[model samples]
Target: MALLEVRDLVVSYGKIRAVKGISFDVEEGQIVCLIGTNGAGKTTTLRTLSGLIRPAKGSISFDGTALTSVPAHKIVSLGMAHSPEGRRIFPRMTVEENLRLGAYSRRDKETDDDLRKVFDLFPVLAERRSQPAGTFSGGEQQMLAMGRAMMSRPRLLLLDEPSMGLSPLMMKKIMSTVADLRAGGTTILLVEQNAQAALKLADVGYVLEVGKIVLSGTGPELLTSDEVRKAYLGED
Candidate 1:
């Protein structure tokens, strides 16, 4: 079975149908990227999967268990973590404190080990563990956000716009870490506006337009496709 399954999903903001019957899946230990332009329901898809927004219709199943009706907190405990857009770290809290909060639902003996793993992934976070998250540069805050999500020891991770609001160098740094995360055994469902970076890292890429999947293929396939190259890859 797929590690994550979103089937015929529909979501709405009042009368505005945001996700109009979308479907997708992520396999274990694979990086799956959802790429689209703004207002294309990319964020909406992640939010619904993370339980921030309830779906109007369809099923969301993780590890073969239905999660559509589960609360966000409950979903976290079920081994899924969401790193939302805008790098929503606790501004006033110490970096360590924010990371600790991510493990609130975890009671396993390996909690400390997981924390160490996150530290290793972003050594800068360890260096600034005592500092307020708000004090870090945008790139640093983004690292902290991913580190915080790692605290949960999730089986599947949902990343929304992980490279947003960062310099080109910072975007490369963060994207490299995402590749490392997959090597370390975390399944990822990534929603990103940065189509190039996302497709490069993804095992499979799905293109979303107007709340529906318009195309999907392996990373290099989409990268080399004439249509995808013209529309998203910015080929002349």
Candidate 2:
């Protein structure tokens, strides 16, 4: 069975639908990416799966447990961590404090070990552990945000637009970190506007347009497809 299964999911903001009956699954130890342009409801879909936005219809099951009715905090405790769009780190908190918050749900001594692991993953964070999160540069803040998410020791990590507001160099660093995380057995559901970067790193890819999936394929298949090349890769 898939580690994370989303079946016929629908989400709405009042009368307007944001996700119109979409379904996807992420297997254990796979990186599944959803690529779409702005306003295509990619972030909305991630939010719904993360339990930040309640679904209007359909079911979300993670590791065979029903998640559609769970509270956002409960979902995280259940081993799904969401690193939201815009990198919403607590501005006044120290880098260490911000990361500690991610482990609030856990009582195990291993949480500290996970914190050390995150620092190892992003050494800049270790260097600035005592500093306020707000003081970091954009790229550094994004790294801290990801490191904070890692503190949860999640089985499924949901990432929304990790490369937003980053320099080209910063974007490369962040995406490479994602690849490294996947290699370490993290199952990820990624939403990205950078189609080229995302597809290159994903095990499988799905394209969303107007709140529905338009295509789904393996990474190279989507990368080489004529429609994807024209619409997302900017190739003629």
Best by TM-score: 2
- TM-score for all models, in order of appearance: 0.97, 0.98
| lDDT, model 2 | 0.91
Worst 10 residues of 1 by lDDT: 106-115
Positional deviation of residue 133's Cα in model 2 after best superposition, in angstroms:
0.6
Q: Give the per-residue lDDT of model 1 (tens digit) for 9-57.
A: 9999999999999888899999999998889999899888888899999
Best by lDDT: 2
Q: Pull out the clashing pairs in model 2.
A: none
User: In model 1, which regions exceed 4 Å deviation?
Assistant: none
The digit string of per-residue lDDT tens for model 2 on 165-218 reads 899998999999999998998899888989999999999999999889999999
- Runs in model 2 lying further than 4 Å from the true structure: none
